[model samples]
Target chain A: MKPACKSCTKEHEKTNYLHMKQQIIEILTELRPEFDFTQDVDFIEAGMLDSFDVIMLVNTLDEKLGISIDGMDVVPENFSSAEKIEALLKKNGVK
Target chain B: MSLKFTYHNKRICGILTVLPQREVLFEEEMDNYNFSPAKSMKLKLAMGFNKHRIVDENTNVSDLAVFGINYLLNNQLIKKEDISALILVTQSPEHFLPATSNIIQGKADLGTDMLCMDINQGCGGFVIGLMQAYSLLEQQEIKKVLLINADVLSHKVSKRDRNSYPLVGDAACLTVVERSETPETIHAVVNMDGRGASAIQIPAGGFKMPGTPETAEVKEDENGNFRSLENLVMKGDEVFNFVQTKVPPMIEELLKIAGKTTDEIDYYFFHQPNKFMLNKLADKIGVPREKMPSNVVENFGNASGATIPTAVSFNLGDVALTHSYEVCFSGFGIGLTWAAIVQKLEKLKFNEIIYY
Candidate 1:
């Protein structure tokens, strides 16, 4: 069984997605170790994250940290930067 | 009573067409570029449409439609025969009244014995037009239907609408639908939400929101222009959610109905909007990297209804139609609409089929 979502523990609006950047970085590095997430460049625009990689990213977010990601949540604003992804997860109540 | 149904009968018989931003030919200075600051920074959160050409200040919606019709009629040996019907789908029309279809019918010389009309559908207009053509062909009496889709959203798009600047590029697209010797049945389903209608919509210029001095003059942004984002404000996040929520599932249901899976599909041609949105949809559906079609946004901008066929035509060589076995086409956005259909491409090259 999947663990309870950490995001569900807090208000959807008040959660801090920015705080999860490091964790996201670490997970991404593990998934695609060659990915140098340290760049200020946008992962998607830079051609690093294609559709295949994005699903892996979303799938991991759902598995490790416990967040409910919806389809609309995948836009560039949310997933382009690590900070944005963190914020989206927090919005979903990711602790 | 039940009839034995078939999913593979109708094939994408002839050829598909795609026009880049060069076609619309915008005359306004505001139509020059996607001024969004995020684009340079790579934060292209919204779709970025560089410069679009709808009709150089000289031409209008009608002119663009006729261009496509001439191409279609000239190619086939239909013998100046009366078309069974003509459907023009557009958000941009010349006058406030008569259908754009009339102009196309007049230009194509398709006889009056045909049914001619316009459908005011948004982005999904092209696909819907194809379905209508499908219906007419099913009757057996109608043999060919010409579907023309054109839009000059720049008319409504304010110059300074930074967010929507990249969101819209003016253009027109036309597809000649015919009863295939092996016609593509175009089994399809269209979904929409009037509530979400306001998500990506214009506030004036139509029946519901007539244009007024106040509505027209208001500067939506610091740039003092109005386009899709300003005149037609899109709750970017919300609209994204709407498509994300609706499109993937719809594609799944479509594939299920067709009794096929991702592995069986040769290609999934989507309306090129943005890399982010395309990647998101492709990810959600588990579509393989190779099976996915071209994302023409980097070049054509978003030609509204034209993107699907454009992608089909753009990636023709990559998929190697014969080897892939089948290709699927889908379109989303605008009308808050979404649709998908499966097709098998005949082994004819575009040059061989269209003779272009």
Candidate 2:
């Protein structure tokens, strides 16, 4: 099989990141339907996400994305927003 | 490391959970949290925090154990003379010198011939206590073991601390383990990570961190929960992560060692941390929601090591007394420990919950 060219690989990475971002938003929305997860706001500061919700989100991400998130990375910062959660997933080698 | 073992001719004959009559609702403790009512209510819904049983300041572990032991003895559900060993598992001990099990032995008049010891453990104490009982039953002389798991953690939890107080409960579970002639095979496993010992603990009151006036000073944590060094402190995220990552694998290992599948198990009577944690765990482990009862914490609070047996008695009390089932009992927490036991529990002589 021929290796992908640099430009194609970059485009693929961007597409994967966007897909993960959308999935994260969907998961967060399911967890707390009342919250507007689409907005780029700090879920923790807004009182939309608590410890229980964070744990639930971690479990859901692990199940849906097939990634094992390290316990050390379960801090509030990683789960404070959808973009942060996508970054966390990438850090966990989600793609 | 996972410590796996198997036993023959051993069975858990009965379980009785004694809960304090006092009940405190989450609605009443809403003001304790720094979060707004709306946020706290959302948490209450997610965590399944309705009410929990708590003991008064005067009540202790021994009080509940004595009451339960006497109940079994007076009701003739168990003969006092048949008890070969008494194991009291608790994080809250009445004194530092003499063992709390000795105190219960004296109070319950359980006779001097049997062995008496105290195991300082938390949530994983129930399964650990049962393992100890099975070990005692290995001896030819030992016939039956009376394992008591009780904790009065409410006294150690700061009421103003929303994280721990609302979920903290005071209860005792008295389980009867005996040597059965039916040659039943029981598989058990225990795994511990001492590195996470501080995840759930009271910083003071122990020999290492003796309780001082300074330790009693209340301070607010970043999460807005208030507690003293002497009070129970739980890093919610750390503990939740530990359970989510570690427990399901431990349960899988247990089922594999036992040569059984999830479908073969009748119930997963686990330590009730809360509804949210348990629901996530059930989903991860591929177990049906009905099989794993998470209502114990909401109805009776998280009684540390006592939650496993309390879950069993509360949910299976009536049917378990008359029918046999292949049950899995698991507990994870405190010692940063997680343990499980899979066996056929046959027609318990008594399985019930009583209010103290």
Best by lDDT: 2
lDDT of 2 by residue, B88-114 (tens): 999999999699999999999887889
Per-residue lDDT of B168 in model 2: 88
lDDT of 1 by residue, B1-356 (tens): 11112332443433445242343322243334443332223333223333444334566666666665566557662334646777777777777767778866776566877888888777677667777776676666776666666666655665455455545655555555654466444446667667667777777777766777766665444333344322766665566677778888888887777778888887787776665567667767888645665455554556577666656666664344454357667777776777776666555333111211
Q: What lDDT score belongs to each candidate, Candidate 1 first?
A: 0.61, 0.88
What does candidate 2's lDDT look like per residue over A1-95, in tens digits? 43389898888878877887888888888778888998878999988888867866776777677666665567888888887887788788876
- For candidate 1, report its TM-score: 0.72
Strongest candidate by TM-score = 2
Lowest lDDT block of 10, candidate 1 chain B: B347-356
lDDT of 1 by residue, A1-95 (tens): 44367666454424444346678888767655667997887887776664435655766676687544666676665677777777788676676
Q: How far is candidate 1 from the true structure (C-alpha RMSD, Å)?
A: 8.9
Give me the displacement of residue B274 in model 1, in angstroms.
1.6
- For model 2, what is the C-alpha lDDT against the true structure? 0.88
